[model samples]
Target: MIEPDSSGDRPSGSAPETTGRFIVVFAETEADPPAFLRSAAGLSNVADSRDFGHGPVDPATAGDADATVFASLGVAVVTADPQQAGALRMSSDQSNIESISPELVHHALSQGTLSPPSALFQDTEHFTWGLQATGAATSPRTGKGIRLAVLDTGFDSSHSDFAGRQVTVESFIPGEDPQDGHGHGTHCIGTSCGPRSSREGPGYGVASEADIYAGKVLSNSGSGSDGGIIAGIEWALVNGCAVISMSLGADIAQVHPPYTAIGRRVLDQGSLIIAAAGNNADRRQNDFGFVGAPANSPFILAVGALDEQLDLAYFSARTLPVRGGQVDIAGPGYRVHSSWLMPDRYNTISGTSMATPHVAGIAALWAEATGYRGRELWSVLVQESSRLQAPSVDVGSGLAMAPQE
Candidate 1:
């Protein structure tokens, strides 16, 4: 069920407007989107609109027989003249046209200091201490049949480690290929769905055998608009991905309506969306920043970062329930090592970004082990987590753990 935005009028503290002049309009689940969109006086076709499996509805017949065509989908991205953006918002009834939010920019959550790979232990087959802490090392489940989607900068498809693996790549960022030019996506993917072994060392992946859906939402510059990320989410859902991992976000105090809707929709569809809790905290100085947008939506699982000693990372944001953002769990993030784009092959980075994929990969393992999906899967993750001494606001239920065989 779509919850009403409790803040009444759209808050100014929500996601910043995108540089691009466009607004995403979401229709009611029972409304005829084509007809409704066509009725909007200023609505225009966005260049290169692809049919995302709803069988393209004709604008002419949208009000008639095809009125209900987009009823089930409940979402649409439309472009309007910049001068008419406000009028478009005013026209929405907050029902059939549920929301009209400006597409906002999202960035990779890897803004922390890079550390030497040696900072992480190398004794295990997987260089990441996260994999071991989450029990992925000994868990019987390999996430063989599960499909996990990672929406980020993209992946290093040419990497030898993932050669011959089942990877489906797509780029929502215009003029960019689904390849990891910025290296952030590759490292995140390496942690969540990478292989079991590589020439560099033991495989640092979690759901090693899981099918990978690498969606390039962010660009080479490591930033993306909310439109691209939403498109990627739609693609992942349409493709039947069991878990969608987002290691990217924007720091917004108010919960974005689109994400709240999307998160609820995904949960209803039996898939889980996990996102980073943001890396804005400086605990040493008593600065525990708030979680970011998307993750700020209560429906999405927000993950925080923990160090090797199980202490909250200095940069891991804490949950502020009053602000509607809360951490759901924690994962090893400090000085974590994982796959990087070739030539470099591997890198050690730290952030809530790194911790998110650990939960995602572990979620895949739990899904494979228990056959749980959606909200049930989410509960399993929380219920089965290894409790830590940390506060719930900082580390959620506890450290996210892999399901035991």
Candidate 2:
């Protein structure tokens, strides 16, 4: 029942081009990735190859018979010869090549219409309502000793609130540093891994003591390619991050093969990838659209947005269950406040993008409290969430909550 978008028009503000000339070729579980590549080189031109963990293979000796077999996550990003690429796809170990597809683009899911702080009652930090609603405020566990990765634009390393925090950062965006120029990443990080409190406001963060691994997959302009995102995922897995939160996505109706594969692989490796369900819905207009790519994949946890009243946010996307993009959970997103780049260190924004980190931060707490990882951790989150009146199509298991312990 999952149908592809017939309208060729790309989502608004999305990058027009796909991930450049390179193509991603995934090796099947039983096949040896490096061995398969070496054998294929005899029939087709294999330029450069990169295996997870071992890094990039030398182009000159890529075809060496003794090449180490890529056993874990067995994926490779290769530059194929234009003439034989087609034949290679056809002849490549049909059993081993799980999928051959063009790398697509991904974007930060933040919507416009930034609201002023005064929109919510000023006496209390209404932005932190998400924390209170999820029981993160009272959770005895602080997500200590856990590594949580937020893959997005980047983090504002200069933010005073995180001055002494254990934050490790890496940038996948070409020619860009990890410093957050776009506020979206900073905001998401603020919610997931920020401290107890800041000078600008009360604590709006969830897993305050969790170690933060900010992976900048999107650039300052708030856009990036699938290659960058895949690389970021690999990095997170290599570093043993227990939870990977992605607040960025593209409005594609169909599931992307790469993300599906990556999501499964990450889960198998004991890491959970959480993504926004996107902010493309407008119930007032009666346009409840499908969840976006990456998130649409059944393996990734897709989250929807709610408002201060715990009602579904007007813009929160609902899953087309027939299409496999069901909302897995919900969190406060409308006019939510969080840290921004310095000088103006705080701002309020809305989107499923904002809601995703709330689940992530709470996931960290659950992980720390229950010692659960990967799919087990995912199950605990859904089982422990506060069920709301909303349909599963709109809010899945309902609002994600922090562990009571």
Off by over 4 Å in 2: 1-127
Clashes of each: 0, 0
How displaced is residue 168 in candidate 1, in Å?
0.2
Candidate 1 clashing pairs, residues 3+ apart or interchain: none
**lDDT by residue for model 2 (240-346), tens:** 99999999889888888888889999999999999999988998899887789888898899999988777889888889564558999998887877899898898
Give a tens-digit lDDT track for model 1, residues 149-244. Answer: 999999999888888899999999999999889999999999998865566676678999999999999999999989999999999999999999
TM-score of each: 0.69, 0.69
Candidate 1: residue 43 lDDT (0-100)? 48
lDDT of each: 0.80, 0.80
Model 1 off-target regions past 4 Å? 1-127
True-structure lDDT of candidate 1: 0.80
List the RMSD of every prediction in angstroms: 24.6, 24.5
